[model samples]
Target: MAISDVPPADCPPWLVPVHTLLLGIGVLCWDATYILMTRRALATKSYGMPLLALAVNLSWEMVYVFYVCEAVLETTGFFVWLLLDIGLVYTTIRFGPHDWKDSSPWVGRNIGCILGLLTAVGCVGHYTFAVWWLAEPGRGIGGDKRGKWWQGREGLDTTELAFWSAGLSQLNLSAGSVAMLLVRGHSGGTGYAIWFFRTMGTLFGLILDNAFMWWYWPAGYGFIVSPFAVFIWGTSMACDIVYPFLLWQVRRTELLLPDGRLVRCDSQPASTASSDHGKKKR
Candidate 1:
């Protein structure tokens, strides 16, 4: 597609005025809260799972920024998505688990490693495909009129890899949610609430994303289905907005240790000895 096929360079004329307004409001809220939390004195203290939520928010923000930039989106939209996936994997690796002994730590770490590998492979594949598309824009996999460049065969492969990575990430989130649910009695109520919201929003986002990917299958219809494209894009942006807000809420109410240290809770069941001691003390 010619560059002109994309919306105007200044402000995509095609985007509805409401989309712009909502996106602006969302960005404002996200940036203000993020800045406030980062500058708060307690920021130096441990934020528990809130930190991971923030990381997820920031990763989506990166994707949004790239999407808004016409130059970047036109030149490297596929690669930009792949890069965002890599960043997401890195963030999951860095802050997913609250404690080393938690089962979620192992699950999250392994999933992050796998996602990282897939993203790396996707990056290479996308780059290679971009080179080939540039060399022969007319050549296509099937005899489609849109041409090979628009077909996004390479991008499709990368997106497929991303789909699996996202699926694994969802599983990791589910494991974390289960761990939180099982240990809800021990954690602060606010923390559990944050997890609930984060997990629910993420789950919804994944489901919608899966639907979008599925709809584009058989012959890839995203370009033809404008409404579907908008739905996927909008849902992604919504996920970005919700994640940081949940993190801010969690950070605001974290419990502290008696000695002013941050208390890290584990998900493991209590030993029988501990249970007996607690019963006797009670």
Candidate 2:
């Protein structure tokens, strides 16, 4: 936002801050939506869903914060978002049990078991594809002279690899949110607003990660055939294109209640939705 933050003409200096700031805003907007939804779930004590997004997103932020992004804005933004992920993870842990209490008593009784397992899976999934984590000398282990540990991975594309995780998460976010609306019905754990922010966040990311980089980085970093970058960029573009239409569907559909039940916004009152929920419970 400041004049000093601007980069040289040959390169897009402004992009770094823009990308990082948008990331932070997107994380907050996302988690804030979860917070609202979690509160509603807790208040109603209805059902709780799995924590796929929470685990995956938290893992991505961890990789970026510790191993990927190291600049001032980038680092600070990632750290802040990492903290928010913790909050979301906490919320999920708190209210996510009711989903399987009766259906799967063992899991509901000890949901932490699932979170621990997912965390391990998430860590491995992120590290497996993350380039810098495997190639950075003295970055992974305490004693390591040779940085390249794996074959065919010595010349890994860090930027694109980072976005692979990012892009997939974004796509997961778009698809999963639509599924969530169906599952939650009027359950109130999310809203169209969350999707709006999410969609905008990807647009901001594309501006820097794809558009700016395509124009600027070719002159400097050279055009690396990064599968990760290509994958994420393609996914981001695809998801961004579908987001608006999906958002429209959400608005056009029946109204939702705090507990995820459907109601007629024009004909039925809030009390009627509650009555419907009660009938379903019976």
Candidate 3:
């Protein structure tokens, strides 16, 4: 019997809790990020995260909560995220258009509608891909992505799929939101709280990556270096590393408007920086 075939009750207590702690905490940080993003959008009437990333994340949560195996700790986390993501979806559709309002109100609404529909399409695609990947045998992986090392019981590897898709989504999110902050050249909706939650997500992401690689990599297979693992985790870590630095650069440029709103430093009048600096020196 393959390790994937191992029943939930048979899983070691220590393993389930540890896995849940690492994965769940990281997920929570991401949830918080989304919540803040939602608030930022409502307050500033601007979008925070890329709709593509948001859509993908919502799909991931939906999949795990509904279709994936029901491990107590893991499924519980997914269930919570599923509930939280509904609000995120609403926020995405609500605020995504305002960013494009200068073009036309219709344009903004169109963009929102398009992204929401595409996200729905993306959910179906994500589910199909996960199901297909899970169906493949967990044979010894080689440099090639699919290895035919063994023919074990047919089953789904939920953890592996989550890391590949959902985890990868998170990796994109860290960098994507920061990129939005830079491009808009404003911190109106995105502030320290957004960055703070993102940082927590990134930190916990690294922990989960390390934990999975060290503890669960190719349980029976002899050191299978799957391409999905390499690409997903590898790319994620690279982006995660750069996220903090981008955040700091964004912070340096933040300014407080006379109306008591915060935006990127460049958005304000030139005197804003000097006045703030002078105040600091006082």
Candidate 4:
């Protein structure tokens, strides 16, 4: 059965439309963010997602598509995301080393292998967590049928599972984006478009979606307002909000090369700049 077939038992019929709308906005925006990131990464020849964040995200999607999610719609969404994530992964494997060349040449040299190892580990870790969580009777149910688990015709609380997993993923993505921006000192694969879509996606997907769910179905979603969830999403939101301004400042001192490299224009001499640019192009 599908999510549409089983709205949480406690959710009033009138409320389902709003809940669906909120959820849809979140999902759509997140998909847009993925598209933008992929496009930007290709255009800039830079990996848009942070290495560890992508590893965690890809693993989560892989596990959900394979074992956790059962509904047609949810599974389809996860599958689509997994495909997009593969695109991001390709860009990272292709261009990620360029970003790390100066500061961490060893990492730059072996980025592909390192990412492979991390993703494998992430898949095992996520799968094991899912197995442990679902094996428990009441834990998967999240208290009672009238609670959030009713959203699924099946007893498994895929919603709750997604909540925790996706929350951590969002945190890592947001935090990593900030760190990546500062570490690179230039906007290469990232830009205002990515930032807007990512922030709005998180707002709709994680923040607003959970808030709306808790407002209507408190029993199952009370964790939404709890300290930890608050801290996770809240911190992510702050980082996302702060990123674009930093991007603006960085752009003032950075130049985008025709070949898709970003270089420092403010600190170096024109002769040195020309030489460095030529070498980077080569």
Local distance difference test, each candidate: 0.36, 0.52, 0.58, 0.76
Say which candidate scores most in TM-score.
Answer: 4
**Tens-digit lDDT string for candidate 1 (230-279):** 45444544544454454444334443443232333332236532453222
Which scores greater on lDDT, model 2 or model 4? 4
Candidate 3: count the clashes: 1
Model 2 alpha-carbon miss at residue 205, Å: 2.4
Per-candidate total of colliding backbone pairs: 0, 6, 1, 0
lDDT of 2 by residue, 1-282 (tens): 111122335555566555456546555555555545455455544322336666677677777677655456656766876765554566566655654444476776677678777767887788776764545433321221221222333323444445557766666665665565555443334445554555656665533434554454443222223555556556656755665565455446555454554432443465765575423310
Q: Which residue pairs show collisions in model 1? A: none
TM-score each candidate. Answer: 0.35, 0.62, 0.72, 0.88
Global Cα lDDT for candidate 3: 0.58
Off by over 4 Å in 4: 1-10, 140-155, 266-282
Query: RMSD to native for every prediction?
Result: 10.2, 7.8, 5.7, 3.7
State in Å the error of residue 274, model 2.
Answer: 9.6
lDDT: the better of candidates 1 and 2? 2
The global Cα lDDT (0 to 1) of model 2 is 0.52
Tens-digit lDDT track of model 4 for 1-282: 115424565678766567657777877887888888888888888888999999999998999898887767778888988877877888898997877877898999999999999989989988998887676445632344333342343455556667788888899999999998887777777888889988988888777866776687766566677778889998999999899888887777776665767765553447756775522311
Worst 10 residues of 3 by lDDT: 142-151
What shift in Å separates residue 211 of candidate 3 from its native position after superposition?
3.2
